[model samples]
Target: VAQHRANVRLWWTRSSLKEHTAGLSNANIPLFFPKLECIDNANQSHLHRLEAVVAAKCVRPGASLRSIGAADVRGLCGGWLYFRQRGGSPAGATFCKEGTCRMGCTSSAEERAALARSKQIEKNLKEDGIQAAKDIKLLLLGAGESGKSTIVKQMKIIHESGFTPEDHKQYRPVVYSNTIQSLVAILRSMPNLGISYGNNEREIDGKMVFDVIQRMEDTEPFSEELLAAMKRLWTDSGVQECFGRSNEYQLNDSAKYFLDDLDRLGAKDYQPTEQDILRTRVKTTGIVEVHFSFKNLNFKLFDVGGQRSERKKWIHCFEDVTAIIFCVAMSEYDQVLHEDETTNRMQESLKLFDSICNNKWFTDTSIILFLNKKDLFEDKIRKSPLTICFPEYAGAQEYGEAAAYIQAQFEAKNKSTTKEIYCHMTCATDTHNIQFVFDAVTDVIIANNLRNCGLY
Candidate 1:
């Protein structure tokens, strides 16, 4: 008898839900809508009406609750429970009596949690912005094309999230310009070097090639035909003779790689890869600041042009500088300055280093020397002896020995008793090499800062 009573009660509840949902055919009706009317039944008491409403919420097959979402179910149960606790209605009417159910419906907890997290993130970002404004400053000083800009770029790659595809696209034209400039420089300098093709009859061809290159401007975009002409000229005997004596001219380090890929670079839709961007040379005339954070410390790196003409601007940027990274092109020993062909490039770097080291203003500053372009130096040392440039000293043909000898030459210039020069061999184009050097540099700067503060 008890089981039969329970079955009958459940049937009545499901039947009521079906009728409320318009016979279950209108199941798409929003769950919050007033599906249950509170018109007093002729034979049912207030308690029975409330009980039927509660029983309708049960998860039975015929119950319309199956069509509603879980959130709506929660709202329904919460609203019914709240209504029941308030003693329901006196006219045998309960929840949703005259209007839509509004109780138990509130903002989602997930949304509220997300809002809180957003606020905290905003606060942290504000704090970080303030910190970045007052970051430690470091200046990169080196002669033109000595890889100072490359080191700055490597810093961005290591700590500033690296180059994107967009950066690659932007650098395509710059790489092409670098390639053209190098070929032009080689062509222009061939006559001065007393190099030529085998016979006197072909001298007119060399003159034509030189005039074509001289007329072409680095600022202008290269035409495909011009690119093909350059490729053809690159293989010509006269151009080959100039290339063989490349160390005599101020050619870019990237000239060889780009010259070899003239066909690809000449393509209308050429895109520069990351390595090409790294090797691409664009002389920095003004100070370019790159900001990045590492080890909870913010850093502002300044890359300025290394030419003698740009050195006057260096004095203005010395304020609050944490450290100085002086880059020396190790392979430049055999080359001369682009500005004055009479001055040896390595000698220029040494003289500049001497002046900077002796400057009383930088006496307290930590000096880190980057003997840059190790790859080119290694290759150059094997082909041409280092003794040719520094005839006073005798050294082995080995790369390490030559690099070490050159490193010592720069270190010997430090006049400050307090400032010990730290040195590292670097190939700025290589990210892994730069990362390792920068990691050590960070430690060196931090330790020096602590020592100055008497906190070490």
Candidate 2:
């Protein structure tokens, strides 16, 4: 009976030790000392023998079995657990006497220290998430080839580290392709416009230009022969006259610039300049993001393709936008849509702006109107009439008066009374103009975000 009673006491003691130690092990703290193997080896068939073994192996010397508590056993085994929790290894743990055992007891200090570090990391992550949420997200939306991509390039030149030599090299082919394509477009449109080459002798030169455009791949550099032929055709007065009526046909805005600079551009070791890169026309197909920091605030600018086919992909980027920069090629007032020639380009832009400015997705979003291509607009207004786009326009064809009338036409598209349209005249190709305009636009974005946050 006494042996049975002792067995009961031993079992109870082992149970107590397991209950206390389970928590420490579950916490991943390594229990390295006072090995539990001693208990595992105890002879279970004889209750008295098991009790004797536990008392001799687990308890401190001269300590009675009844007097030793679970805590004492834990103190001997959990010292390493405490050490590890404090970022110390068992090999590095200093053995110290505690109350009744040579092994150390768990200290609340280590757990508190670990917990504090974890909390600090979590706090930092939360702060970063909040700051990211606070970043100004500007969505660039406009008609196709309205220089939305040019504005993005200007941002790179001004805010971020400007393009590298490798970047200039990469754009070389694009510049060359643009130059070739522009001339080809002009040559193709000449017959439709009933305009012949100024030099009848150079008609073969025009044919050579066409044949090269058809056979030559985009990656191929322009051969000297083809470059010579293009130069001859570009210099023809009749071809120049056809180019003057470029608005009647779908011509790239940079065609004239590149065609005039064929000599330097066609050189063997030619590298594209900053101006060349800005003027290069590569259609934006999907959403492209440009990240930069300005005035201690982070910005995420999104440039989505503006073509009718590419507009469907834009909804994926509509969420969480801070502002919308709706661009319009004011110079395209006399032009028609490349997609649908019957529809006027400026009219298409206005229709697009009206939809975006009043869309349910952007109801609360700030809308900033960019009257882009001011330089081109000023030049075109001298020859073409604003009445091409807006039939009601009775104003003079001067830059200032004509630009205001165009701006009013866009401003009239806003149906919302609460939402205000902030408009600016921008020349996307000019870095100085874009830099100045973006600075002001940044201020407006910051103010709008602040107001949205109820900071004002």
Candidate 3:
């Protein structure tokens, strides 16, 4: 007979099925009982006795679990069974409960043994997933028009298609992202995080660990919104934040976009709109390959262009790179210098170099001065002499003449420099030449090992 009562108050007195069940086989009647952690066919003393057990969790219909029968169910049965948070809010949690069940069961009060097999299987899967990551050191740097995306594509396709010599289409990849989310995510993960307290805004210690989250449950009561936000921050890597800005950071993407770009433009003349953001296409893409092996180390980097107003942003990237790559765009002085606008751009790059060389990140960083678009220049003008048109030298003014002119400009400002900067030319399309830049970076890394050199 089936008994149903909300106030029945079924308290499971532990019993063994073999001893209590007698000849009561499940064939006569399949009894539905309250949450049961363990079942024994040995006794049938008390009908539906509960020592401890997890609740019956619903599996997706036609899922792999359907193939699991009574044996698998018994094998998996445990007082600490768990559910996955693939989606939705598991409002609270529970560990043990006093509930009722039907049919023959054992009695007495003894803490049940936990399931070891299933737990071990889950542990193994996690370890394997972490080990699968490719542990390669990389330096990603490029401008929007530069063939950086192409290079990344070539590397990926070559590994996939096994290096085809007959025909190779130039590769291209489009990358873009927002900022605020990236900052909050990394910051939230830190221990002993500082939080504003009350109206006084006194800083307070407020830090939570992930393990505490994994141990939470639905019935126990917890903040669904907080949990969801935490999970989302860990899952996504497109959000960005600028460290170059003041202590406060923007959380909105559009707001951040306008601020960062506006700050870069230094435009006091006119205000920008959402339409500006919609039409915003990066004039240049900056890629810096930063590799790490700290569990989940997904990076969301921001492109800080070498434009004069934007030069300062590069300082932010310094504290976050495996290696720093300096892009020197190749353009004929007479051609690219056609307008005053372009002259300012060239000047901006020079100023940036000066800033970078003196920054603290400079001494420890592996540097590569990538003079891209070398194909446009005469192949014979491999090494820049003291004289030559800035980027062109076919009947172009000598490097020294241009250098002297540049030097004279500095002298006029009472800031003449003596040391010459070594600049390497590279046609971004040429992999062999690019590899040299890569090796140069490696050599520097060996000279100064900085794998765990975190923020100051």
Candidate 4:
């Protein structure tokens, strides 16, 4: 029983408690703990209460041992140590005088350390509140499919350390829908390509597979039979030939990748991998704000729909934005918009960019023009002539030539002469590329902020 008292004494001593325990002994346990079962129960109860009090007062407040006062520590562990007032003597003295003891405790070195640590914690919290108030708001302004959302996703991947398992799982339905939409597009364009099941006498097997693709579209349950049909259509040399001519039809960049993995993706229990989720195409309808901290700078990135109808909402979110990341789909030079088939997508994006640049609300906002989808742009430039969209682009039919012409056009049209338009060629789906570009963008934003503050 004395050993138990010794352990309790050790605990309290390490806890920075400097109180005297003169009348406190194992034999006198019944005097203080009438309800406890035994000495063990009383000791356990005393230890638990001491721990809780210490945590609430000192430990949980980020206190160091040296910063916590001895009196406070003694109060936390005082249950095990009894104190009585002594006649005309020090309150915390160990020995008694005239059957009277008084409670008094001196501050220890550990208690002083606790006080220091508590002060440090308060200082850190204050700094954090200041940093929170100094948050930077970045707005992503682009036409639909201009890689705005992709860049936002990249920010999450880089800053938040990628999506959770649940986030990856949620993309399953989106991947499936993208696959269906791509196949439907190819099927719809088959007739225009002068190749259908009713015609195309030069390729009998192509006609059969073409008919299978149409039939699989209506099949329910997406059963193994449908999977086999799609696989047959996908693997057919003639169909493969048609897909290779991607510019002839309106197909997503993810079409070939998704088609190549029909068996796995078509599985009932299929879970989307990170790459699949990254490549999956889900059109942005409204604004999505994502907050993340990168390189000690807090960023709130806003992504809004690029269609004309959705442009009205963009004006509401433009207030106090630190910078504008204007995304231009470099690959859409020849393609028309889904919202307005009569207007070319690239032309519409250019007009929208002009409006955003000239707006008085964003006169001071730094513009970052991202010529996104470089991979698709390269392929599209090779297949489709640049002259089809902009006849005055007198550059050679080359990637660099076309890209430079487009960049020059945008730079020439930008109305914000106060801020230099920062432009970069980017593929947003590429994480490594985004990380590099984002690091550069961060430096630019920080420098710009410092320059603005200097002027103020």
List the candidate 2 regions with Cα displacement exceeding 4 Å.
1-134, 306-317
Q: What are the clash counts of all predictions, listed in order?
A: 0, 0, 51, 24
Greater-TM-score candidate between 2 and 4: 2
How far residue 37's Cα lies from its native spot in candidate 4, in Å, is 83
Candidate 3 lDDT trough over 10 residues, lowest sum:
168-177
| Off by more than 4 A, model 3 | 1-314, 337-345, 379-423, 450-456
Q: Can you rank all candidates by lDDT, best first? A: 2, 1, 4, 3
Index of the highest-TM-score prediction: 2
Comparison by lDDT, 1 against 4, better one: 1
**Root-mean-square deviation per candidate:** 22.5, 18.0, 28.0, 17.9
Encode model 4's per-residue lDDT on 1-456: one tens digit a residue: 233323333321122222232344433432322211112333465454443333323323442222334333333333233332334222234422221113444444544454345444345444443453456789888887788888988988888978888997778777866776676677667667765533344244334444545675433335575567667667665566667666655688889888899988888888888788888887777668899987777888888764557566558557568789999999989888775677888888889888888877887888999999999899779878998789987878889999999998888877654768999999998999989998998888877765443321
Model 1: per-residue Cα lDDT over 172-261, one tens digit each: 768867887787788778789987654554555445545545675553556765665676777778788898789888788899899998
Residue 244 displacement in candidate 2 (angstroms): 1.0
Candidate 4: deviation at residue 366, Å?
Answer: 0.4
Candidate 2 clash pair list = none
Question: What lDDT score belongs to each candidate, Candidate 1 first?
Answer: 0.67, 0.72, 0.34, 0.66
The residue ranges of model 4 lying beyond 4 angstroms of the native Cα positions read 1-134, 197-222, 267-269, 313-316
